[model samples]
Target: MAGSRFVGHIKMWFFFVPLLSVALMPAAPDPSLFDIPDAEAASVASSLGEVRTADAIDTTNRTFKHYFVATGLVQASMASSGETQIEDGGVANFASRWVHNFWRLVYRMVYRITVMKYWLLGMLVFGIAMFTDGTVRRKVRAAAAGYVSPLSFHLAGHGILLVFGVTFTVLIAPLPLIAPYWLAIAACLGALLWKAASTYQ
Candidate 1:
Protein backbone atom coordinates (compact mmCIF):
# COMPACT_ATOMS: atom_id res chain seq x y z
CA MET A 1 0.00 0.00 0.00
CA ALA A 2 2.85 2.47 0.85
CA GLY A 3 4.69 1.87 -2.48
CA SER A 4 1.49 2.37 -4.49
CA ARG A 5 0.76 5.78 -2.75
CA PHE A 6 4.38 7.04 -3.40
CA VAL A 7 4.11 6.06 -7.08
CA GLY A 8 0.74 7.90 -7.50
CA HIS A 9 2.22 11.15 -5.92
CA ILE A 10 5.23 11.08 -8.29
CA LYS A 11 2.90 10.73 -11.31
CA MET A 12 0.80 13.69 -10.12
CA TRP A 13 4.00 15.88 -9.76
CA PHE A 14 5.13 15.04 -13.28
CA PHE A 15 1.76 16.12 -14.89
CA PHE A 16 1.29 19.32 -12.81
CA VAL A 17 4.94 20.56 -13.38
CA PRO A 18 4.63 20.35 -17.15
CA LEU A 19 1.26 22.22 -17.11
CA LEU A 20 2.63 25.04 -14.93
CA SER A 21 5.77 25.51 -17.09
CA VAL A 22 3.61 25.77 -20.21
CA ALA A 23 1.36 28.41 -18.57
CA LEU A 24 4.41 30.62 -17.56
CA MET A 25 6.27 30.54 -20.95
CA PRO A 26 6.23 33.81 -23.19
CA ALA A 27 4.40 33.63 -26.58
CA ALA A 28 6.43 33.83 -29.82
CA PRO A 29 5.48 36.66 -32.39
CA ASP A 30 4.47 35.79 -36.00
CA PRO A 31 7.18 36.48 -38.59
CA SER A 32 4.66 37.72 -41.23
CA LEU A 33 3.50 40.72 -39.07
CA PHE A 34 5.49 44.02 -39.43
CA ASP A 35 5.58 47.68 -38.25
CA ILE A 36 3.99 50.60 -40.28
CA PRO A 37 5.47 50.95 -43.80
CA ASP A 38 7.87 53.93 -44.27
CA ALA A 39 6.58 54.54 -47.87
CA GLU A 40 2.95 54.78 -46.74
CA ALA A 41 3.81 57.20 -43.92
CA ALA A 42 5.83 59.44 -46.28
CA SER A 43 2.95 59.48 -48.80
CA VAL A 44 0.48 60.56 -46.14
CA ALA A 45 2.78 63.40 -44.98
CA SER A 46 3.31 64.61 -48.56
CA SER A 47 -0.43 64.58 -49.25
CA LEU A 48 -1.09 66.77 -46.17
CA GLY A 49 1.63 69.23 -47.30
CA GLU A 50 0.12 69.45 -50.81
CA VAL A 51 -3.28 70.26 -49.33
CA ARG A 52 -1.75 73.06 -47.26
CA THR A 53 0.07 74.52 -50.28
CA ALA A 54 -3.15 74.54 -52.35
CA ASP A 55 -5.01 76.29 -49.59
CA ALA A 56 -2.29 78.97 -49.38
CA ILE A 57 -2.45 79.63 -53.12
CA ASP A 58 -6.22 79.93 -53.06
CA THR A 59 -6.04 82.42 -50.21
CA THR A 60 -3.50 84.60 -52.07
CA ASN A 61 -5.62 84.73 -55.21
CA ARG A 62 -8.74 85.64 -53.26
CA THR A 63 -6.89 88.49 -51.55
CA PHE A 64 -5.63 89.94 -54.84
CA LYS A 65 -9.09 89.81 -56.43
CA HIS A 66 -10.60 91.62 -53.48
CA TYR A 67 -7.98 94.36 -53.69
CA PHE A 68 -8.52 94.88 -57.41
CA VAL A 69 -12.29 95.06 -57.02
CA ALA A 70 -12.04 97.65 -54.30
CA THR A 71 -9.68 99.83 -56.31
CA GLY A 72 -12.01 99.73 -59.33
CA LEU A 73 -14.97 100.73 -57.23
CA VAL A 74 -13.08 103.70 -55.81
CA GLN A 75 -11.99 104.94 -59.22
CA ALA A 76 -15.51 104.67 -60.62
CA SER A 77 -16.98 106.66 -57.76
CA MET A 78 -14.38 109.40 -58.16
CA ALA A 79 -15.07 109.73 -61.88
CA SER A 80 -18.80 110.04 -61.30
CA SER A 81 -18.27 112.71 -58.70
CA GLY A 82 -16.05 114.80 -60.98
CA GLU A 83 -18.54 114.54 -63.83
CA THR A 84 -21.36 115.76 -61.61
CA GLN A 85 -19.33 118.73 -60.38
CA ILE A 86 -18.38 119.84 -63.89
CA GLU A 87 -21.97 119.64 -65.10
CA ASP A 88 -23.26 121.62 -62.11
CA GLY A 89 -20.79 124.45 -61.98
CA GLY A 90 -17.72 125.07 -64.15
CA VAL A 91 -18.74 123.90 -67.64
CA ALA A 92 -22.37 124.93 -67.28
CA ASN A 93 -21.61 128.56 -66.38
CA PHE A 94 -18.84 128.97 -68.94
CA ALA A 95 -20.83 127.43 -71.78
CA SER A 96 -23.87 129.55 -70.99
CA ARG A 97 -21.87 132.79 -70.95
CA TRP A 98 -20.01 131.96 -74.15
CA VAL A 99 -23.18 131.09 -76.05
CA HIS A 100 -24.84 134.33 -74.94
CA ASN A 101 -21.94 136.54 -75.99
CA PHE A 102 -21.51 134.75 -79.31
CA TRP A 103 -25.12 135.26 -80.32
CA ARG A 104 -25.01 138.93 -79.33
CA LEU A 105 -21.96 139.49 -81.53
CA VAL A 106 -23.64 137.73 -84.42
CA TYR A 107 -26.71 139.95 -84.14
CA ARG A 108 -24.64 143.11 -84.09
CA MET A 109 -22.63 142.07 -87.16
CA VAL A 110 -25.77 141.15 -89.10
CA TYR A 111 -27.29 144.57 -88.43
CA ARG A 112 -24.15 146.41 -89.50
CA ILE A 113 -23.79 144.39 -92.71
CA THR A 114 -27.45 144.93 -93.64
CA VAL A 115 -27.34 148.72 -93.04
CA MET A 116 -24.07 149.46 -94.87
CA LYS A 117 -23.70 146.76 -97.45
CA TYR A 118 -21.99 148.66 -100.30
CA TRP A 119 -19.61 150.65 -98.05
CA LEU A 120 -18.62 147.54 -96.05
CA LEU A 121 -18.05 145.62 -99.27
CA GLY A 122 -15.75 148.32 -100.62
CA MET A 123 -13.77 148.49 -97.38
CA LEU A 124 -13.43 144.67 -97.32
CA VAL A 125 -12.01 144.74 -100.81
CA PHE A 126 -9.57 147.53 -99.86
CA GLY A 127 -8.52 145.72 -96.69
CA ILE A 128 -7.84 142.47 -98.52
CA ALA A 129 -5.68 144.29 -101.08
CA MET A 130 -3.72 146.03 -98.32
CA PHE A 131 -3.23 143.08 -95.91
CA THR A 132 -3.11 139.88 -97.99
CA ASP A 133 -0.12 138.02 -99.54
CA GLY A 134 1.61 140.91 -101.33
CA THR A 135 3.21 138.65 -103.98
CA VAL A 136 -0.07 136.97 -105.03
CA ARG A 137 -1.93 140.28 -104.98
CA ARG A 138 0.77 142.04 -107.05
CA LYS A 139 0.82 139.21 -109.56
CA VAL A 140 -2.94 139.21 -109.90
CA ARG A 141 -2.96 143.02 -110.11
CA ALA A 142 -0.21 143.15 -112.78
CA ALA A 143 -1.83 140.38 -114.79
CA ALA A 144 -5.34 141.90 -114.69
CA ALA A 145 -4.34 145.60 -114.69
CA GLY A 146 -5.14 146.54 -111.04
CA TYR A 147 -8.05 144.00 -110.74
CA VAL A 148 -7.52 141.90 -107.57
CA SER A 149 -9.00 138.40 -107.50
CA PRO A 150 -10.40 137.63 -104.01
CA LEU A 151 -9.79 133.86 -104.22
CA SER A 152 -6.20 133.70 -102.93
CA PHE A 153 -6.80 136.18 -100.12
CA HIS A 154 -9.93 134.48 -98.81
CA LEU A 155 -8.47 130.99 -99.08
CA ALA A 156 -5.31 131.83 -97.19
CA GLY A 157 -7.08 133.67 -94.36
CA HIS A 158 -9.92 131.20 -93.93
CA GLY A 159 -7.71 128.13 -94.30
CA ILE A 160 -5.22 129.37 -91.73
CA LEU A 161 -7.97 130.38 -89.29
CA LEU A 162 -9.78 127.09 -89.69
CA VAL A 163 -6.64 125.00 -89.09
CA PHE A 164 -5.57 127.03 -86.07
CA GLY A 165 -9.04 127.04 -84.53
CA VAL A 166 -9.60 123.33 -85.00
CA THR A 167 -6.18 122.40 -83.69
CA PHE A 168 -6.36 124.69 -80.67
CA THR A 169 -9.88 123.75 -79.63
CA VAL A 170 -9.52 120.02 -80.15
CA LEU A 171 -6.29 119.81 -78.21
CA ILE A 172 -6.91 122.38 -75.47
CA ALA A 173 -10.65 122.90 -75.01
CA PRO A 174 -12.65 121.17 -72.29
CA LEU A 175 -14.77 118.12 -73.11
CA PRO A 176 -18.08 119.97 -72.79
CA LEU A 177 -17.21 122.66 -75.42
CA ILE A 178 -15.38 120.46 -77.93
CA ALA A 179 -18.41 119.29 -79.93
CA PRO A 180 -20.17 122.65 -80.37
CA TYR A 181 -16.94 124.55 -81.06
CA TRP A 182 -15.75 121.94 -83.54
CA LEU A 183 -19.08 122.14 -85.40
CA ALA A 184 -18.86 125.94 -85.59
CA ILE A 185 -15.35 125.77 -87.02
CA ALA A 186 -16.46 123.18 -89.60
CA ALA A 187 -19.35 125.35 -90.72
CA CYS A 188 -17.09 128.37 -91.19
CA LEU A 189 -14.70 126.21 -93.22
CA GLY A 190 -17.56 125.08 -95.46
CA ALA A 191 -18.71 128.64 -96.11
CA LEU A 192 -15.17 129.77 -96.85
CA LEU A 193 -14.65 126.86 -99.24
CA TRP A 194 -17.88 127.75 -101.05
CA LYS A 195 -16.79 131.35 -101.46
CA ALA A 196 -13.35 130.31 -102.70
CA ALA A 197 -14.90 127.97 -105.27
CA SER A 198 -17.28 130.59 -106.58
CA THR A 199 -14.46 133.08 -107.15
CA TYR A 200 -11.85 130.58 -108.37
CA GLN A 201 -12.03 131.47 -112.06
Candidate 2:
Protein backbone atom coordinates (compact mmCIF):
# COMPACT_ATOMS: atom_id res chain seq x y z
CA MET A 1 0.00 0.00 0.00
CA ALA A 2 2.88 2.37 0.74
CA GLY A 3 4.55 1.56 -2.59
CA SER A 4 1.24 2.20 -4.43
CA ARG A 5 0.78 5.51 -2.57
CA PHE A 6 4.31 6.50 -3.48
CA VAL A 7 3.66 5.63 -7.18
CA GLY A 8 0.46 7.78 -7.16
CA HIS A 9 2.33 10.73 -5.66
CA ILE A 10 5.05 10.33 -8.31
CA LYS A 11 2.41 10.36 -11.06
CA MET A 12 0.83 13.51 -9.63
CA TRP A 13 4.24 15.24 -9.45
CA PHE A 14 5.08 14.16 -13.04
CA PHE A 15 1.82 15.68 -14.29
CA PHE A 16 2.29 18.93 -12.31
CA VAL A 17 6.03 19.39 -13.04
CA PRO A 18 5.57 20.85 -16.53
CA LEU A 19 2.87 23.23 -15.29
CA LEU A 20 5.17 24.54 -12.54
CA SER A 21 8.11 24.84 -14.97
CA VAL A 22 6.01 26.76 -17.50
CA ALA A 23 4.79 29.11 -14.77
CA LEU A 24 8.34 29.80 -13.66
CA MET A 25 9.69 30.44 -17.17
CA PRO A 26 10.62 34.04 -18.03
CA ALA A 27 8.62 35.88 -20.66
CA ALA A 28 10.24 36.55 -24.01
CA PRO A 29 11.75 40.02 -24.43
CA ASP A 30 10.13 42.49 -26.84
CA PRO A 31 11.64 42.55 -30.37
CA SER A 32 12.51 46.23 -30.55
CA LEU A 33 15.08 47.34 -33.16
CA PHE A 34 16.47 50.16 -31.03
CA ASP A 35 15.72 52.24 -27.96
CA ILE A 36 15.00 55.96 -28.38
CA PRO A 37 17.75 57.81 -26.57
CA ASP A 38 16.81 60.52 -24.05
CA ALA A 39 18.31 63.29 -26.19
CA GLU A 40 16.51 62.11 -29.34
CA ALA A 41 13.23 61.79 -27.41
CA ALA A 42 13.68 65.29 -26.04
CA SER A 43 14.49 66.61 -29.50
CA VAL A 44 11.34 65.10 -30.95
CA ALA A 45 9.30 66.61 -28.11
CA SER A 46 10.93 69.98 -28.65
CA SER A 47 10.27 69.88 -32.38
CA LEU A 48 6.64 68.94 -31.92
CA GLY A 49 6.36 71.52 -29.13
CA GLU A 50 3.16 71.35 -27.10
CA VAL A 51 1.48 69.13 -29.70
CA ARG A 52 3.41 66.19 -28.27
CA THR A 53 3.61 66.00 -24.49
CA ALA A 54 5.93 63.68 -22.54
CA ASP A 55 3.34 60.89 -22.68
CA ALA A 56 2.94 61.33 -26.43
CA ILE A 57 6.72 61.34 -26.87
CA ASP A 58 6.96 57.97 -25.09
CA THR A 59 4.08 56.59 -27.16
CA THR A 60 5.67 57.80 -30.40
CA ASN A 61 9.01 56.27 -29.42
CA ARG A 62 7.38 52.91 -28.71
CA THR A 63 5.42 53.10 -31.95
CA PHE A 64 8.60 53.85 -33.91
CA LYS A 65 10.29 50.78 -32.39
CA HIS A 66 7.33 48.58 -33.27
CA TYR A 67 7.28 49.99 -36.84
CA PHE A 68 10.99 49.33 -37.23
CA VAL A 69 10.68 45.70 -36.09
CA ALA A 70 7.67 45.04 -38.29
CA THR A 71 9.23 46.69 -41.35
CA GLY A 72 12.58 44.99 -40.70
CA LEU A 73 10.88 41.59 -40.72
CA VAL A 74 9.08 42.44 -43.96
CA GLN A 75 12.29 43.72 -45.60
CA ALA A 76 14.20 40.60 -44.49
CA SER A 77 11.47 38.33 -45.84
CA MET A 78 11.44 40.22 -49.16
CA ALA A 79 15.23 40.03 -49.43
CA SER A 80 15.16 36.29 -48.74
CA SER A 81 12.53 35.78 -51.41
CA GLY A 82 14.50 37.87 -53.98
CA GLU A 83 11.41 40.04 -54.40
CA THR A 84 13.51 43.02 -53.27
CA GLN A 85 17.19 43.73 -53.71
CA ILE A 86 19.21 45.94 -51.41
CA GLU A 87 21.44 47.95 -53.68
CA ASP A 88 23.91 50.79 -52.96
CA GLY A 89 21.50 52.90 -50.91
CA GLY A 90 18.02 51.79 -51.82
CA VAL A 91 15.74 48.85 -52.62
CA ALA A 92 15.18 47.66 -56.19
CA ASN A 93 13.06 44.88 -57.62
CA PHE A 94 10.07 44.24 -59.82
CA ALA A 95 6.93 42.98 -58.13
CA SER A 96 5.82 41.08 -61.23
CA ARG A 97 7.31 39.39 -64.28
CA TRP A 98 5.50 41.88 -66.53
CA VAL A 99 7.31 44.77 -64.84
CA HIS A 100 10.76 44.74 -66.43
CA ASN A 101 13.78 47.07 -66.47
CA PHE A 102 12.62 48.85 -69.66
CA TRP A 103 9.20 49.63 -68.19
CA ARG A 104 10.77 50.77 -64.92
CA LEU A 105 13.15 53.10 -66.76
CA VAL A 106 10.31 54.73 -68.71
CA TYR A 107 8.18 54.98 -65.53
CA ARG A 108 11.01 56.61 -63.62
CA MET A 109 11.65 59.10 -66.43
CA VAL A 110 7.97 60.08 -66.46
CA TYR A 111 7.89 60.27 -62.67
CA ARG A 112 10.86 62.61 -62.59
CA ILE A 113 9.35 64.85 -65.23
CA THR A 114 5.87 64.95 -63.76
CA VAL A 115 5.02 63.20 -60.48
CA MET A 116 8.31 63.77 -58.63
CA LYS A 117 8.16 67.57 -58.97
CA TYR A 118 4.63 67.81 -57.60
CA TRP A 119 5.37 65.27 -54.86
CA LEU A 120 8.37 67.31 -53.67
CA LEU A 121 6.28 70.48 -53.66
CA GLY A 122 3.57 68.73 -51.64
CA MET A 123 6.17 67.48 -49.15
CA LEU A 124 7.60 70.98 -48.72
CA VAL A 125 4.16 72.43 -48.09
CA PHE A 126 3.37 69.70 -45.58
CA GLY A 127 6.67 70.22 -43.73
CA ILE A 128 6.12 73.98 -43.45
CA ALA A 129 2.58 73.44 -42.22
CA MET A 130 3.78 70.90 -39.64
CA PHE A 131 6.45 73.32 -38.33
CA THR A 132 4.01 76.17 -38.08
CA ASP A 133 1.39 74.06 -36.33
CA GLY A 134 3.96 72.67 -33.88
CA THR A 135 5.24 76.17 -33.08
CA VAL A 136 1.75 77.52 -32.53
CA ARG A 137 0.64 74.60 -30.36
CA ARG A 138 3.81 74.76 -28.26
CA LYS A 139 3.35 78.48 -27.59
CA VAL A 140 -0.30 77.93 -26.65
CA ARG A 141 0.50 75.04 -24.30
CA ALA A 142 3.38 76.95 -22.66
CA ALA A 143 1.09 79.86 -21.98
CA ALA A 144 -1.74 77.66 -20.62
CA ALA A 145 0.45 75.12 -18.76
CA GLY A 146 -1.90 72.39 -19.95
CA TYR A 147 -1.74 69.53 -22.44
CA VAL A 148 -2.96 70.31 -25.96
CA SER A 149 -4.22 67.57 -28.26
CA PRO A 150 -1.77 66.79 -31.08
CA LEU A 151 -4.61 65.57 -33.27
CA SER A 152 -5.60 69.10 -34.36
CA PHE A 153 -2.04 70.00 -35.32
CA HIS A 154 -1.63 66.85 -37.36
CA LEU A 155 -4.99 67.32 -39.05
CA ALA A 156 -4.42 70.97 -39.91
CA GLY A 157 -1.02 70.18 -41.42
CA HIS A 158 -2.13 67.07 -43.31
CA GLY A 159 -5.52 68.41 -44.28
CA ILE A 160 -4.14 71.51 -45.98
CA LEU A 161 -1.66 69.46 -48.02
CA LEU A 162 -4.26 66.83 -48.87
CA VAL A 163 -6.61 69.54 -50.10
CA PHE A 164 -3.86 70.95 -52.27
CA GLY A 165 -2.94 67.49 -53.48
CA VAL A 166 -6.51 66.68 -54.48
CA THR A 167 -6.92 70.08 -56.12
CA PHE A 168 -3.68 69.65 -58.07
CA THR A 169 -4.77 66.25 -59.26
CA VAL A 170 -8.19 67.46 -60.37
CA LEU A 171 -7.03 70.66 -62.04
CA ILE A 172 -3.84 69.39 -63.68
CA ALA A 173 -4.43 65.70 -64.27
CA PRO A 174 -7.14 63.85 -66.15
CA LEU A 175 -10.21 62.93 -64.12
CA PRO A 176 -10.08 59.31 -65.32
CA LEU A 177 -6.47 59.01 -64.17
CA ILE A 178 -7.09 60.54 -60.70
CA ALA A 179 -10.71 59.53 -60.00
CA PRO A 180 -10.03 56.13 -58.44
CA TYR A 181 -7.42 57.37 -55.93
CA TRP A 182 -8.75 60.88 -55.24
CA LEU A 183 -11.82 59.78 -53.30
CA ALA A 184 -9.75 57.59 -50.94
CA ILE A 185 -7.29 60.39 -50.19
CA ALA A 186 -10.10 62.91 -49.75
CA ALA A 187 -11.96 60.60 -47.34
CA CYS A 188 -8.86 59.95 -45.25
CA LEU A 189 -8.05 63.68 -45.02
CA GLY A 190 -11.63 64.56 -44.15
CA ALA A 191 -11.82 61.90 -41.47
CA LEU A 192 -8.50 62.97 -39.93
CA LEU A 193 -9.56 66.63 -39.88
CA TRP A 194 -12.89 65.76 -38.27
CA LYS A 195 -11.25 63.63 -35.59
CA ALA A 196 -8.57 66.23 -34.86
CA ALA A 197 -11.01 69.13 -34.62
CA SER A 198 -13.31 67.09 -32.38
CA THR A 199 -10.44 65.95 -30.14
CA TYR A 200 -8.94 69.43 -29.82
CA GLN A 201 -12.23 70.98 -28.76
Candidate 3:
Protein backbone atom coordinates (compact mmCIF):
# COMPACT_ATOMS: atom_id res chain seq x y z
CA MET A 1 0.00 0.00 0.00
CA ALA A 2 2.87 2.46 0.79
CA GLY A 3 4.66 1.76 -2.51
CA SER A 4 1.44 2.35 -4.46
CA ARG A 5 0.91 5.69 -2.65
CA PHE A 6 4.49 6.82 -3.42
CA VAL A 7 4.08 6.02 -7.11
CA GLY A 8 0.79 8.00 -7.31
CA HIS A 9 2.48 11.01 -5.66
CA ILE A 10 5.38 10.85 -8.12
CA LYS A 11 2.91 10.71 -11.07
CA MET A 12 1.09 13.85 -9.82
CA TRP A 13 4.38 15.78 -9.35
CA PHE A 14 5.53 14.88 -12.87
CA PHE A 15 2.27 16.10 -14.42
CA PHE A 16 2.24 19.50 -12.50
CA VAL A 17 5.97 20.19 -12.99
CA PRO A 18 5.55 20.46 -16.77
CA LEU A 19 2.45 22.69 -16.34
CA LEU A 20 4.32 25.05 -13.90
CA SER A 21 7.38 25.28 -16.15
CA VAL A 22 5.21 26.14 -19.13
CA ALA A 23 3.43 28.85 -17.17
CA LEU A 24 6.71 30.34 -15.88
CA MET A 25 8.17 30.74 -19.36
CA PRO A 26 7.92 34.25 -20.81
CA ALA A 27 6.08 34.86 -24.07
CA ALA A 28 8.03 35.69 -27.22
CA PRO A 29 7.63 39.35 -28.24
CA ASP A 30 5.92 40.17 -31.51
CA PRO A 31 8.19 41.22 -34.37
CA SER A 32 8.42 45.00 -35.06
CA LEU A 33 8.72 44.64 -38.85
CA PHE A 34 4.95 44.17 -39.13
CA ASP A 35 4.25 47.57 -37.48
CA ILE A 36 4.92 49.72 -40.54
CA PRO A 37 1.91 50.51 -42.70
CA ASP A 38 2.34 50.67 -46.48
CA ALA A 39 0.16 53.75 -46.81
CA GLU A 40 2.07 55.72 -44.18
CA ALA A 41 5.40 55.02 -45.84
CA ALA A 42 4.02 56.16 -49.18
CA SER A 43 2.62 59.35 -47.62
CA VAL A 44 5.97 60.29 -46.07
CA ALA A 45 7.82 59.69 -49.32
CA SER A 46 5.31 61.80 -51.24
CA SER A 47 5.74 64.78 -48.86
CA LEU A 48 9.50 64.98 -49.54
CA GLY A 49 9.07 65.29 -53.31
CA GLU A 50 11.55 63.82 -55.82
CA VAL A 51 15.28 64.34 -55.35
CA ARG A 52 17.15 65.18 -58.50
CA THR A 53 20.54 63.85 -59.50
CA ALA A 54 21.53 67.37 -60.62
CA ASP A 55 21.94 70.46 -58.36
CA ALA A 56 18.17 71.24 -58.54
CA ILE A 57 19.02 74.73 -57.24
CA ASP A 58 16.63 76.61 -59.52
CA THR A 59 13.76 74.29 -58.61
CA THR A 60 13.66 75.63 -55.03
CA ASN A 61 14.16 79.30 -55.96
CA ARG A 62 10.42 79.84 -56.22
CA THR A 63 9.95 78.62 -52.65
CA PHE A 64 12.61 81.06 -51.46
CA LYS A 65 10.96 83.93 -53.36
CA HIS A 66 7.56 83.12 -51.89
CA TYR A 67 9.00 83.08 -48.37
CA PHE A 68 10.73 86.44 -48.90
CA VAL A 69 7.57 88.05 -50.24
CA ALA A 70 5.48 86.77 -47.36
CA THR A 71 8.01 88.00 -44.80
CA GLY A 72 8.20 91.40 -46.51
CA LEU A 73 4.42 91.81 -46.31
CA VAL A 74 4.44 91.08 -42.58
CA GLN A 75 7.29 93.56 -42.08
CA ALA A 76 5.51 96.24 -44.10
CA SER A 77 2.27 95.82 -42.17
CA MET A 78 4.08 96.11 -38.85
CA ALA A 79 5.93 99.20 -40.00
CA SER A 80 2.75 100.87 -41.24
CA SER A 81 1.02 100.31 -37.89
CA GLY A 82 3.71 102.45 -36.18
CA GLU A 83 4.07 99.72 -33.62
CA THR A 84 7.69 100.75 -33.10
CA GLN A 85 6.38 104.07 -31.73
CA ILE A 86 8.98 106.27 -33.45
CA GLU A 87 7.06 109.43 -32.55
CA ASP A 88 6.68 109.64 -28.76
CA GLY A 89 5.33 112.77 -26.98
CA GLY A 90 3.01 113.68 -24.11
CA VAL A 91 0.03 111.62 -25.24
CA ALA A 92 2.06 108.59 -26.23
CA ASN A 93 4.02 108.72 -22.96
CA PHE A 94 0.86 108.95 -20.87
CA ALA A 95 -0.87 106.12 -22.72
CA SER A 96 2.25 103.94 -22.55
CA ARG A 97 2.68 104.51 -18.84
CA TRP A 98 -0.92 103.60 -18.05
CA VAL A 99 -0.97 100.54 -20.31
CA HIS A 100 2.34 99.26 -19.05
CA ASN A 101 1.35 99.67 -15.39
CA PHE A 102 -2.01 98.03 -15.98
CA TRP A 103 -0.46 94.99 -17.71
CA ARG A 104 2.16 94.74 -14.98
CA LEU A 105 -0.53 94.59 -12.33
CA VAL A 106 -2.47 92.02 -14.34
CA TYR A 107 0.61 89.88 -14.72
CA ARG A 108 1.45 90.12 -11.02
CA MET A 109 -2.08 89.12 -10.00
CA VAL A 110 -2.10 86.22 -12.43
CA TYR A 111 1.30 85.03 -11.24
CA ARG A 112 0.29 85.26 -7.60
CA ILE A 113 -2.72 83.06 -8.31
CA THR A 114 -0.57 80.48 -10.19
CA VAL A 115 3.01 80.75 -11.30
CA MET A 116 3.32 81.18 -15.10
CA LYS A 117 -0.21 79.80 -15.48
CA TYR A 118 -1.41 82.39 -18.00
CA TRP A 119 1.78 82.03 -20.01
CA LEU A 120 1.27 78.30 -20.27
CA LEU A 121 -2.39 78.76 -21.18
CA GLY A 122 -1.48 81.22 -23.94
CA MET A 123 1.19 78.84 -25.24
CA LEU A 124 -1.24 75.93 -25.32
CA VAL A 125 -3.79 77.97 -27.28
CA PHE A 126 -1.14 79.17 -29.73
CA GLY A 127 0.15 75.64 -30.23
CA ILE A 128 -3.32 74.38 -31.07
CA ALA A 129 -3.79 77.18 -33.60
CA MET A 130 -0.39 76.55 -35.13
CA PHE A 131 -1.13 72.85 -35.49
CA THR A 132 -4.51 73.53 -37.09
CA ASP A 133 -3.09 76.11 -39.51
CA GLY A 134 -0.18 73.88 -40.39
CA THR A 135 -2.50 71.02 -41.24
CA VAL A 136 -4.56 73.29 -43.45
CA ARG A 137 -1.45 74.64 -45.21
CA ARG A 138 -0.15 71.12 -45.70
CA LYS A 139 -3.37 70.05 -47.39
CA VAL A 140 -3.37 73.18 -49.53
CA ARG A 141 0.25 72.67 -50.51
CA ALA A 142 -0.39 69.03 -51.40
CA ALA A 143 -3.17 70.09 -53.71
CA ALA A 144 -1.13 72.94 -55.27
CA ALA A 145 2.62 73.23 -54.78
CA GLY A 146 2.75 77.02 -54.51
CA TYR A 147 -0.32 77.57 -52.34
CA VAL A 148 1.46 77.38 -48.97
CA SER A 149 2.88 80.68 -47.68
CA PRO A 150 3.81 82.12 -44.30
CA LEU A 151 1.22 84.88 -44.89
CA SER A 152 -1.51 82.26 -44.81
CA PHE A 153 -0.74 81.48 -41.16
CA HIS A 154 -0.42 85.19 -40.31
CA LEU A 155 -3.72 85.99 -42.03
CA ALA A 156 -5.48 83.16 -40.24
CA GLY A 157 -4.30 84.41 -36.85
CA HIS A 158 -5.28 88.01 -37.66
CA GLY A 159 -8.64 86.90 -38.98
CA ILE A 160 -9.38 85.12 -35.70
CA LEU A 161 -8.37 88.25 -33.74
CA LEU A 162 -10.40 90.56 -35.99
CA VAL A 163 -13.57 88.53 -35.57
CA PHE A 164 -13.35 88.64 -31.79
CA GLY A 165 -12.34 92.31 -31.77
CA VAL A 166 -15.24 93.35 -34.01
CA THR A 167 -17.72 91.30 -32.06
CA PHE A 168 -16.70 92.81 -28.71
CA THR A 169 -16.58 96.31 -30.16
CA VAL A 170 -20.03 95.99 -31.73
CA LEU A 171 -21.58 94.46 -28.62
CA ILE A 172 -20.32 97.21 -26.34
CA ALA A 173 -20.57 100.13 -28.76
CA PRO A 174 -24.38 99.88 -28.76
CA LEU A 175 -24.52 100.47 -24.99
CA PRO A 176 -24.71 104.24 -24.35
CA LEU A 177 -23.61 103.84 -20.74
CA ILE A 178 -20.35 102.19 -21.78
CA ALA A 179 -18.84 104.56 -24.36
CA PRO A 180 -15.36 103.58 -23.26
CA TYR A 181 -16.05 100.02 -24.45
CA TRP A 182 -15.41 101.06 -28.05
CA LEU A 183 -11.84 101.91 -27.11
CA ALA A 184 -11.50 98.35 -25.83
CA ILE A 185 -11.48 97.16 -29.44
CA ALA A 186 -8.10 98.83 -29.94
CA ALA A 187 -6.87 97.40 -26.65
CA CYS A 188 -8.03 93.97 -27.70
CA LEU A 189 -6.22 94.32 -31.02
CA GLY A 190 -3.04 95.38 -29.26
CA ALA A 191 -3.32 92.48 -26.82
CA LEU A 192 -3.97 90.11 -29.71
CA LEU A 193 -0.88 91.38 -31.53
CA TRP A 194 1.27 90.99 -28.43
CA LYS A 195 -0.08 87.50 -27.79
CA ALA A 196 0.28 86.49 -31.42
CA ALA A 197 3.88 87.66 -31.63
CA SER A 198 4.98 86.19 -28.30
CA THR A 199 2.91 83.00 -28.30
CA TYR A 200 3.66 81.90 -31.85
CA GLN A 201 7.38 82.17 -31.32
Per lDDT, the best of the predicted structures is 2
C-alpha RMSD of candidate 1: 51.4
| C-alpha lDDT (0 to 100) for residue 11 of candidate 2 | 42
Model 1: per-residue lDDT, tens digit, 108-198? Answer: 2232222223233544454454344444545565677665467565565556454444433322111222223434544555445444443
lDDT of 2 by residue, 1-201 (tens): 647744544444444443443232212122121222344335434544565445454554455446544567534534443544446232233332212322222222232233223234544555456456656656675678767677565656456554554444332221122223434544555555444443354
When 2 and 3 are scored with TM-score, the better candidate is 2
Off by over 4 Å in 1: 1-148, 151-165
Q: What is the lDDT of candidate 3?
A: 0.38
Which ten residues in a row are the worst by lDDT in model 3? 170-179
lDDT of 3 by residue, 1-201 (tens): 647744444444444443443333212122222222344334323432345201122333333345544567434533443334466555544443333333233222222222122133545565566556655646655667553445644654665445443432322121121213323533454444443433342
Model 3, stretches more than 4 Å misplaced?
A: 1-137, 175-201
**Cα lDDT listed for each candidate:** 0.40, 0.41, 0.38
Clash statistics: count for each candidate: 0, 0, 0
Clashing pairs in 3: none
Q: Give all TM-scores, in the order shown.
A: 0.22, 0.25, 0.19
- Decide which is better by lDDT, 2 or 3: 2
